[model samples]
Target: MPNVSKCQSLYSALVSRFQSENPSLVLSDTISSWLYQSIYSIYETSGEEEAERYVREAHMV
Candidate 1:
């Protein structure tokens, strides 16, 4: 699992990329909240190394 600080950084990067994909609008609050939860789920299920790799592979790291 990722530490809080690392998770925060990864979440920000993911959200940024998500928003960038739709320049005209951002994700809904509901979806954004889901994203935060979803990332943590990945970290929890996959462990630190794989989770970090998951984000890094997406250029989030």
Candidate 2:
């Protein structure tokens, strides 16, 4: 089972790291909202493994 809180925390960290690393690139609120929705949808429909995989992939690239 997926721990949604942990996932949320990890996601937040990932966003922060990305923002710090790429200071010039601004992630607007709309984009963050869409990404969060997409991630949550994946977790609900695809299961924990897929959601984790997606997060890992997102972090990598």
Query: Per-residue lDDT for 56 in model 2?
Result: 66
Model 2 stretches with alpha carbons more than 4 Å out? 1-4, 59-61
Compared with the true structure, model 2 gives a TM-score of 0.66
Candidate 2, residue 17: how far the Cα is off, in Å: 4.5
C-alpha RMSD by candidate, in order: 4.1, 3.0
TM-score for each of the candidates = 0.66, 0.66
Model 1 superposed RMSD (Cα): 4.1
Q: Residues 1-61, candidate 1: write the lDDT tens digits.
A: 4576777777787767756866665667897787667667778888667656765566321
Shift in Å, residue 31, candidate 2: 0.3
Clashing pairs in 2: none
Instruction: Itemize residue pairs with steric clashes in candidate 1.
Output: none
- Candidate 1 Cα misplacement greater than 4 A, ranges: 56-61
